[model samples]
Target: MMNRRKFLQGAGALGGLMIVKPSVAFSYAANSTVQYALLGCGKRGTSVATSFAKNTQARIVALGDIFPDQLAKGKQHFDEINASLGFPAIDDKMTFHGWEAY
Candidate 1:
């Protein structure tokens, strides 16, 4: 039988746990990936974004580069990564190039 004393103790424990809350509770849906954008999309950017994709639940959705060739390469690299991870390839609209890309 849960008496008043036991009930109070249980409530106190629960209250203590409630007080210790998460710093930020991310409200992400189940099986949903985090959207990631890579600026520059050079060797360093690809390396960092690749590590992020492999280590975290983030998927590179956008790539931006001043050089069109570099941007294409970046897209190919990320497309392969996404394919291997069972994610769809990045949309063409998300690929930005030219000097104005920042």
Candidate 2:
């Protein structure tokens, strides 16, 4: 029952609404710390974690991997990256290894 003209108008209105910014949004305090854990410390997981570290004011609190070597490597890599970003290095106590890691 609807013509193309009416459909296009409605679609335009909907798109306009989608582009509108929210009136209220949550924001973190300047000194607030956001701790995050990274599981499956493989190539993809490390890449994603690095992206977060590079893009946000987040701290990598924990790194987990089924393999000890992978966990170690991930921790070293994240620590180095975060250090370069003026963030603190991850503590060894927070790193987990073995298949039971999650």
**Candidate 1 lDDT over residue span 3-89, tens digit each:** 999999999997876756344234445556689799998888899999999889988999999999999999999999999999999
Model 2 gets an lDDT of: 0.86
**Which lDDT values do the candidates have, in the order given?**
0.88, 0.86
lDDT of 2 by residue, 1-102 (tens): 999999999999988866665432224344576889999889999999999988988888899999988988998899899889887788888888887887
Model 1, runs deviating above 4 Å:
1-32
Flag clash pairs in model 1: none
Residue 99 of model 1: what lDDT?
80
Clashes of each: 0, 0
Question: What's the CA error at residue 79 for candidate 1, in Å?
Answer: 0.1
Q: Give the Cα error of residue 73 in candidate 2, in Å.
A: 0.9
